[model samples]
Target: MKGTQSLERALDILFALGDDGETQTIAEIAQRISIPESSVYRLIQTLERNGLVERKGQGQIGLGLRILELAKSLNSQFRNRLKSSAAPLMEQLSEETKETVVLFVRTGTNVICVKSVAGQHLVRFVVEDGKTFPIQNGASGKAILAFETSKIINQVIHTIETDLVDDFLEELQVIREKGFSETSSEVDPGIIGIAAPIFDQANHVIASVTVAGPGDRIKDEKLSAIVPHVIKTAKRISSSLSFSTTLS
Candidate 1:
């Protein structure tokens, strides 16, 4: 570790533990990463003191609960950025369509609504923030899932009804082709939903922009009419997210 700075050496120790959450003794980590045992011990002490590492057994160390806290904080920050970027547009969409507008972010195998603007109409569907659903169930979730990597898509596919897997994959392909998704009562009875994916600076799917309402009032030609507006809003939000990243 002579050529490596202290910070770099510490990071190397962390990486040496592997991404699988495997625990290792200091000597094992030092030997695996080709660093001195004394240096590894010193760095582990620093990391343990900061609550980033913990003793898993008598001699083994593993990642600590604080790492999960740090990850949650990071995820919250990204969601906050998405909310800031999508809030104004969500309001505009709700006003234009007279329907509920929602911003959803993928969390694990589910998508959670992070921001929502209720519809102006007397009879409307109210989707509360923090509502969670399977990542492949609703229009908003499908929009996010369709753009995910094949590995992740397959992982989700394996969890569903095997008989429906083919149809689900086909629907995802159509969503990718049309650049948006639409559903009627798939997740909730009597609801219509339209959504498009939002992208980050790296062109990765970060979240989705969605419009939802009572199916009776928003079906057929009416739903079709709102599709373009939802797509446009998604693009605007994606652009805003990229711009904010640039500024930061």
Candidate 2:
């Protein structure tokens, strides 16, 4: 924890939201942390100012963009924990599927790749560690977005094209119901992507683990076989993430 009572309370607010597993109001946050509502309000304002948290609709609060920047120096420990949990599973998945593997975290209305494992095949799709794209673009993004709160879903909806809203939302619903997502030629040409969502202990969708490769090799039948491995690896990483004490 940080020094000073006020700073400590502010950090607890972020932790409380994560533990609760969803957005909450000022009162809910105060009760969860056992602090007065007024004190929580003030601390929340300060945190909001620093880009550490965000206010969802109807006064609910959530982890902000800065909090999701796992690869940055801002929160290296948790990033280390995330990578520690995902790296091996991702590596195993790439070896099993013979395709590129990627881990993605949401940043506001976009999704960023925090880590990647290249495939064994000569013509496989390649992913860069720092790659970023709109939240609506691919299976990697959609897998994470589909599990987010409605306010977040709507927030993203407002950023993309009007015509795309219907189809995108529809696709997200399918992803939510199915617990994964798939896309072809979305991020890159002739590439197919299949992704599964990863959750923290509180059951929040923290990120997504994706398997991607060329269309010719991954065509329908092979894609079906690879899906299960992607999902299983995602679950394994999520289970490892539960060992982390806090988002910090």
Candidate 3:
């Protein structure tokens, strides 16, 4: 292979290892990628030196912690950008409602919490960064799903239990009409979550911003008060992302 071909082959090997998420012997990688065993070994040695791969045992290797280090750095940079765009609005919402505020993005069948601002109360619901949960059962999930096309919803529905599909679609429509979602004691008992979908420059729902709090404090009156703020915050964040994308 030429130098560029060799580099491409090396990347193919890396991708193979990543997809399997298992330790592989030199012969195994060679067979998987149709590379010669000798070439695989040489490529692996170079990858290992750069800390992209690590030996697992005799004649076996797996991805290294260095990949995770790189992932953390990338996630950090992305989170900083999202936080910078949303923090001021989130802080204001938290202060006004005194409830936990969170930002979430879809990941396959789940939504990952990316940023959060804690409520100023002795008792409040707080979601940690990187927390992931099913995209079928909560306000954030519904808000994100509501904006998706029916085709996308059908794709997600295929992953869900056959029995719950109808109700899921029904709720998504309600959220779509209201332009937000609110639920009490759905994910966690005694907690109420309200969320609105955030769109990108193309008007695609890419994320959601939520306000959640103890149910006792978020009864009818309180819920009525916070709903508009949550919706507004989501809109502002979406506008910011759209504007930034336009500039870039």
How close is every model to the real structure, measured as TM-score? 0.83, 0.73, 0.69
**Which one is best on TM-score?**
1
Scored by lDDT, the top model is: 1
Kindly report which residue pairs in candidate 1 clash with one another.
none
Q: For candidate 1, which ten residues in a row score worst on lDDT? A: 12-21
Query: What is the Cα-based lDDT of residue 44 in candidate 1?
Result: 94
In candidate 1, stretches whose alpha carbon ends up further than 4 angstroms from where it belongs are 2-46, 55-61
Deviation from truth (RMSD, Å), model 2: 6.7
Tens-place lDDT per residue, model 2, 112-231, is 889999999878788787789998889999999999998889888888789988988888988888888999999899999999999989999989999998888998789999999989
Kindly report which residue pairs in candidate 2 clash with one another: none
User: What's the CA error at residue 167 for candidate 3, in Å?
Assistant: 1.9
Q: For residue 169, what is the lDDT in candidate 1?
A: 96
Q: What is the lDDT of residue 73 in candidate 1?
A: 98
lDDT (Cα) of model 1: 0.91
Expressed as tens digits, the lDDT of each residue in 29-138 for candidate 1 is: 98888888998999999899998899998899998788779888999899888898899999999889999999998887899999999999999888888999999999
lDDT by candidate, in order shown: 0.91, 0.88, 0.89
